[model samples]
Each structure stands twice: as C-alpha cells, then as structure tokens.
Target: MRLHRSLLTAAAVSGLLLVTACGSADPAGDGTSGGLNPPPLKAPTALGSPEGQVNLIAWAGYVEDGSNDPKVDWVSGFEKQTGCQVNAKTAATSDEMVALMKTGAYDAVSASGDASLRLIASGDAAPVNTALVPHYADVFAGLKNQEWNSVKGVAYGIPHGRGANLLMYDTAKVTPAPDSWSAVFDGASAHSGKVTAYDSPIYIADAALYLSATKPELGIKNPYALDKKQFDASVALLKAQNEHVGEYWSDYLKEISAFKSGDSAIGTSWQVIANLAKAEGAKVEAVLPKEGATGWSDTWMVSAKAKHPTCAYKWLDWIVSPKANAQVAEYFGEAPANARSCAETAAKDHCATFHASDEEYWKKVRFWTTPIEQCLDGRTDVRCVPYASWVQAWNEIKG
Candidate 1:
C-alpha cells in the first residue's frame, strides 16, 4: 500500500536508493533546491543493434501479450518488429515498482509520477535521448520534461498515457445523480459503509485537492504540497470518512466486484473500470466531479543498468508509436501520449470520451507526485510533511 521509509532508508544506506531531493542537499554543487539529482549516468549517444530481448516492469494492462485475452496483445507486434522479445512483470503499486527497479534486472518500467522521481534519484532510471525515440516529437508538449520525468532540464522518460480518477456510483443506488466530490467527503456518511477510496498514500492528495476547493481558507494551492496545518486538516477529513468507508481499494477487479455486489455504491474509479463494470451487467456511472479529481500520468523509463539498452530504446519508441499508443490507451482507458493516436483509436469517439487533448479539462485534475519536506508549493519557513509522513498518517487513519 504505502512505501516503508525504513526500507527506503536501508536501500539508501546500501547505495541501492538515492532520492534526488527529499530535503537532501544537492550532490552536483548546482545549489538547486527541491529538484531530483539523478545519478551520474550517460545518455546513449547512438543507437545500436537490438539485444534480442527486453525485460520490462509495468502496471497491469500496459504490456499486453495476448495472455489475458486471445485478442488483447501488443507485445507480439513489438517483438516481431524490433527483434526484441518481451518479458514483462506487472506491478500493482508504485512502491513495488520502485523496489523491483532497484534489482537492476529489468530494462524499463512504465512509471507513474510518484515512482518516476525516486527512480531517477536512485539511479534506477537513466535519462532518455529523445533522438533515439522518433515518436517522442509527437508527444503532447505539456507532458514533456515535467517535474517527475526530468532533472535539471534533462528528460528521463517518454510520456505514455494519463487519466483522471473519477467518482463512480451504482446508478441504481445513487439517486438524483451526484455531481460533486462532496458525496464522498463531508457527505460521505449519506452512503454509510458503502463509500470507498483508493488504497495508496497518494490518495491523500485527493483529500487535499477537495479541501483546496471547499476550504480555501487552508490555502492549499497544490494538493501534493501542504504545510503542517493543511496536512492535518486533510488527515482529519480522511479519518472522519474512515467511518463510512466500505473498503479501500487498489486492485481494479476488487472494486469492480464490490460495485457489482452493491458493496461499494460510491467510490473512486478510472474510465476503463467503469466500462468493464458496465459491460459486466453492473448498473454503474462514473464522472469527474465538479470539485475536480486527482489522476496519474505514466512515463516509460529505461533502467540505468539495463542489460538490453538498445532494446529498451526500441521499446520506448515502439510503445509510443501512434498505432501502439492508441492500442494501449484504449485498453488501459487513458489518453494516449501520441497526439496522432486520437485519430487511430477504433472507438470513433474514444479521445473525446477521455478528454484526450482537453488541456483546460486537465487543469482541474491534479496529477499525482511524491510529496517532500521541501514543500512543492515553494514555502520556505515551515517544514512540510513528505510522502513518508503521508504513508504513516494513512496507516493511522485506516487503523
């Protein structure tokens, strides 16, 4: 669920982990503050022959090889095209993804914002040479070189896809059609033990995001950046919601099952989950509440110690190619990274349904990122709570 700070500390002491900036001083003498300092690793200057195989760590549904369904396969095409056979492991959480990347056994990972920074800081991931990824130029300008995927203006990964976390309810049970997140916050008790929430520390940002809109007096400009008073307010709200929570969910199938069984009449969800639940005869409806929502953007990053560096580069290019990007985005229920993918999706109105290029729509969706003591919102005086503290607080609330 949450990353254990002690495990990360042990890894850091062993030189297996080195987060760029968790209030730690910069090692490069750049005098920079609050930015990751990636390990000294050279970006590949030129492309080479494929290494015959590439191993990848990714979220579920990222690297489909037809094993899940007879028709839902993309890895086969990648393997056939690049001569780089694919071996993929699906990780369920950012913490698991980070720990796996540290082993130095995989070539790349489809990292979310929360894990991308840690990967770069720990030397688990290396800067990507855009020249090597021809399709990179077609990526949305907004996703490139953002806070999580780059350090000191150097790009670390290629943007893959993004999606907003929306509120889902059993259409038959939630009367009058709810339009705001308040249904799951202050008014969550209306549903009593049928309200659900995501099961990670990052979900704390969702609470903070709600407070940003509902309680502006707290001055929470960025949900991921909060001072002590703001952090305490969010934690207090979650602790109160704990009484009405039916279950906290991380696995998509678990939530889908709960909704089908009428266990979770109201909760958070992604577009794909709602589609699947509706297909399975569940009377469910999902929407981006008026208060906005928290979401995730994924980056495909190469391992610094990759055994198949050339293949890794090839995979990066292949995955983000217009056709492949469309496939994965449609399957995973997120906006495709390649702008051209909007036209390639089999579903005629796919991009519109996901608001693929609606920049204004994304303004309300606060993407997930690891919180640090330095305060992401740039406050200098008071020490802000970092992700580790969020994890500790989440444990306390659940307990």
Candidate 2:
C-alpha cells in the first residue's frame, strides 16, 4: 500500500551572501563542487547522556510525528527509543532551512545539496565522525563523503534520501509522449498558459541542463557550473518560458491541485508529486526525460551550535536506521540512503520504483549543488556565476 501523500519542496534561497573564490578542487569529480574551504570544527568523539530533547529544521514530510496523518509517524518511535523528545519545524524551502540553522536554535536540519555547502562554509554545520554513526556503514557508498556533504574528505552530515526533478505532463492534454525537456521549453507554446515550472532560483539549472544537449557549443558540463555566457543563455531561455507559464510552483501541493483541476498541463515535478496526483484522479505521468534531470540528495546535518549534541547524534543514527529510513523514503517518495532499507519498505517494490539501489540510473541524474564563483566542473579559465546571481536572474525570468 502507498504509505501516505508525497509532500516535498524545492531548495533555493535568495539574498544570502556566498563566499567568492576560485580554482578549488572538485571533491566528487562528478561535475559538482564544494568550493569554499570550511572553517575548523570537529565532531564529538563519543556520545554523552541524552539531553531529553532535540530540535530540528526539516523539509516537509521528512520529520513526521504522525500528527499530519495518524498512520504516518516516524518521530514518535525515535523519541521513545532514545528518550529524546522530537521537536521539528518544517521549512518550506532550503533557504528557510539555512536561515533557521544560523539562529543556533535547531540541533539539526535535513538539508539539501544547495544548502549544505553554505552551512559548511559559514561554520554553521559541524563535521560528523562516521565512527559514531553505526548505520553509516550501511548507507549507499555513492552518497558518502561526496562534494555536497563533505569538505576536504571530512563528512559534515549523513545522507538521508534522493530523487530527481521530473517532467510531468497531463496524459490527455499533451500530444505524443515527450522524451525530452524541449516539450516544456521550445514547444511550451502548444500548452500556452497551462505550463508550470518550479518556482526557485535552482530552476535555472533545469534550463541550463537542457542547453547542454540542445546547444552543445555552450560547453555546459555541469548545470550548476556556468560562466557568464552560459549563465546568460540559461537565464534567457527561462525568461522566454515564463511567457507560456501558467504558474511557478514551490509548494508541491499547489502543483498537484493545479494538475488535478486541469489548470496545469505540463511542467516540472517529482515522483511523489506525480504519484499523489495520479492517486487524486489526475491523468498525469512524470519522466526523467532524454536530457536527464536536476535533483536533490539531502543530508541530515548537525548544527555547529547544537545545545544537545548527544541527542542530536542519536537522532541522526536513528533516522537513517533501516526501519525509519524505509518509512521516510516510502512516505516522501524518494530513494532511501540506507542500503538495507529496500527490504524494510511496506511496499515490496518501493525500492525498485525509486531506484534506491541503482547506481547507474543515478549517473544520469545531477543532484543539486550550490553554485559558486569557483566552477564546479573545474574550468579554471573563467568564473561561474554564483547562486546570488541566479536568484537575481530568477526574479527577472518571472517578471
């Protein structure tokens, strides 16, 4: 049975200042970069007594206490097992998560790739000694010590889950199944005023990804790593797309409502959003598209200023444990980080549907990474545009 509704949000915050630097080594060497050198901070060597409570800032549906739906509770079990009461604040966007982490109020955050590096660079997030997290050994090797979650080989957090941004279309509204992002870019006029795109600065990367294939000369190796010309071309494409857009959505629920009501015929979406839409009687389907897609690989990070480090560490270990990981992955509609979670899911085929263990399939999907002046794709001749610029361009694209 489907566990519950899939509720997810995009990550992209505007107006936050990013450190400007260049020519840093790309850690993952997968066309993504964590360029800024982080300040010195160490993980606790050993666990102390539970502090009785842990505060967390997380994306919607990541830290459920069953209050949203009586059957969908994971936080309760964690609280009961560790004697650490769970206090969660759901952030609507990654930008809100970064701002919340800065306050030093929350003990941990379920952060997306776009926000992870920023937290590390500012010293707001602390390194995680993998030895303290026994479950870390069971996590997918592909998710460990990667560009977004690590700095100079030191891990800053635990990988939570991942999913791609997909091209979702109304089966009856659009003609001929689209296998490419062009359906939403070049051919968007066919559905004029019915096309919906994700509303965030990160959406710019979607356009850049399309340009990589359509305009080969742009040399867009990584969507997040774009120099002035590449960045401008991407911005131009989105500005044009805006004319046909019915609405730009950050809230997944709004996108579902739009598709169900036939207000939106095509645009970007997630696997969970498409699943929830179909369940609600919307004739919709989501695809990775021939050009591939931009996505998120979220990490559960501890705050550098955590007041309850011991409990915070316990929460991290508990969340990624097989049972809890499976529940969150199923409910959130993403691949579980724990390799063993596949067998633990309520739906026997949940892991296969989400490609939880398919490493090859993940290669086509580019997980979200923060844009920095230092090119993530390792081009030393020019500086790539930073996220701050993308935030400005997004406003222009929408207006």
Candidate 3:
C-alpha cells in the first residue's frame, strides 16, 4: 500500500491507531534541506523504568500468529508472562514509522536502520535499560553500541534481525546467476526495462555499491556516507539504470508481484524473496554481489513515557528469547539478534542458510546505520552529508 501523507498525519494524532504517520519541522527537527529528511525525532532517553501497558509500533511481519504455524507468535508468550496488554501498530515503511512516532503514544517500536536513528534522535525512544532486560546479555556484542544508536558513549537499543540487498534472478531466465549487481544495474538486453530497484532514499546505497566497485578513489565506505563527489557519482549511475527499471519498489509484496508476473526479472532483494519464490513455485534466487551489499538490522526500542514499562521490558526479554527470535528469523528470512535463536530453528540450514551463525558474514555485510555528517569509519573528522540530502538526491536520480 502506498503511504499517503494524510494517513500518516492521522496515525500520529489518533493514539497510534491503524494510523499512517508523517513528520514535519517538529517545531523541533534540525532545519535542513536535501538528503534524507531530518526527522523531527527526539533523542534517546535513559529515563526511569517502563511504566504500565506495553504499546508497540512495528511492521506487520515482525510478529507472526499461529496462522502460519502454531509456534510462531511472540506476543502470546509475552502476554502470559506479563499481564500488560500488548498493543501493536503495524507500519509499512520506515517513513511511516518515523511519522507515527511523533504522536508519543507508543511504548516502543521495531525500527530498521533507516528509521532507528530518527527515533533515537527525536527522543521518541527510551534507551535500553540493560539492567531491566537480562536477555540483553545474550545479544551479540558486535550488534550493540553501533554508531547510530549510540551518542557520545551510551547505547539506545538492541539489534533484532538483519539481511542484505542481493540480486534476485530466475535460474531459468538467466544462466549462471549474475554475480555482480550488474545484471540488475547494467540491465543487459534480456533484463532491459525488466529490472526493479528499491524505492527509498536509502536505496541510493545500492548505487553507491556500484561506485565502490567501479570507483575506488571516491572512497565510499557506507553508501549513505556520500561526500559531494561520491554522492554525485552514485546519482549518475542510478539515472542510467532508470531507463531499464520496470518498477521501483517500496514494499516487498509489490516487488514480489512485479517479479512474479515477469515484469521484472532482475532487481535488488532481501532473502525472503528466495523463500517466497520457492514456495510460490517461481524459479528465483538471490545472489549477494561480490562488491558487497547494504543491509540493516531492526531494533526494538522502548519509550520513556511507556505506560507499562515492566511489561515492555518483559516483552523485550521475551521477544529476544531464543525461541521467539528464531521464530521471527525463520519467518522474516534473516538472522535473529539473540544468540540462542540459532539452535532451535527447525531448518538445519536455517542458521547457515541465512548467515545466522556466520560471524564472518556479519563483518562482511556492511550493516546499514543511519548516516550523519560524521563518517561511520570510526573517525571524528569527516561526516556524511546527512539523510535529508540523500532524500532530495533520490528524487533527482529517480526522476
């Protein structure tokens, strides 16, 4: 579903109802232009413990019901452990999520990298009280204290799940699956005008990937960290691909539809497409290009004004539990944040299949973090152009 700006405004004002959310100057956000829009987001708060009822904002698929399988739902277990009634509002994209947070009604939200920092910065999210969440100790240390969720030296949230932007192609249509992102970006005759690209500002990262391989002097560490020269290089590359792309997808379901109908044969995708394609009998596979792919981890963050703080923490502890995390991993098509989730998965290859147990994969896969003026290369001197700039650049490149 395309998110209309009006619906987003409604969601924020309506108590986090099935509302769509949006952002404005916040009478508070950094006044800026270009790049990704600066979220009127609040910064993280190491506030006191959670309060009463647990209200959460998340994408629909993150929490599953027994409809798919009896053991899949993470909330029921949460409900049983703590009497706090769990209230969930599902958002379709990070933009929608950032919009909803303005209402200040939710206790926590599960945000992808693109939206996580916005929430942390907007002060909408309450920092993870690791003391309250014992299971936090089980999370991979590497996933914690990342630059996006941390400021100065404090951590804001816990990493939930992660996956890459790989090229999904049908083995039947293209022999020897395209290794480089070229099959999609280059748009060979067979794939010409039949390819798709992710329809978000962050997607420019893919273009940056091509630059990283084809242009080393630009030194683009994270595609989101585009200097003026590097940023312009990526924009030029994407403009070239616009001629061949059949669709620019914002939602996974929409991308699946385009690919399934054969309107698009080559495109960037997440692992879920491979699983969905196999189930739907579409001859498709996803290949992570050797040039490296951009990926992100979802984070579960609580709000300081939470009505049910204890329940919120209990939910956190439960969701990251080995069983709960694995259930989400199997269904979501990626590795879970909690370490023990790797063991209980029914699929033997589940762990390896999704890079669940691969520490090397974690290092190799450039995890997406919200880009800022400062470089993510662990340096204090250089900084990114900012997200608002990327957003404006995306429009120019797409048009």
Question: Could you say which candidate leads in TM-score?
Answer: 2
Q: What TM-score fits each model?
A: 0.89, 0.93, 0.83
TM-score of 1: 0.89
The superposed Cα distance between candidate 1 and the true structure at residue 128, in angstroms, equals: 1.1
Of the two candidates 1 and 2, the one with more favorable TM-score, higher being better, is: 2
Top of the candidates by lDDT? 2
What digit string (tens of lDDT, one per residue) describes model 1 on residues 2-60?
Answer: 11111111122232232434443222212233545567888999988999999999887
Give candidate 1 misplaced runs (Cα > 4 Å): 1-34
Model 2 weakest lDDT span, ten residues long: 1-10
Write model 2 residue lDDT over 1-399, tens digit each, in one string.
232222223233442446655346574543234466678788889999999999998877788888888899888888888999998998766778888899999999999988888898889999998899999999998888778887667899999999889999999988798899999899989999999998878889999999999999999989999999999999999988999999988778899999999999999998888988999999999988999999889999999999998889998998899999999999888999999999999999988888889888787888888888788777777888988888778778888
CA error at residue 35 for candidate 2, angstroms:
1.2
C-alpha RMSD in Å of predicted model 2 compared with the true structure: 2.8
- State the weakest 10-residue window (summed lDDT) of model 1: 1-10
Rank order (by TM-score, best first): 2, 1, 3
In what order do the candidates fall by lDDT, top score first?
2, 1, 3
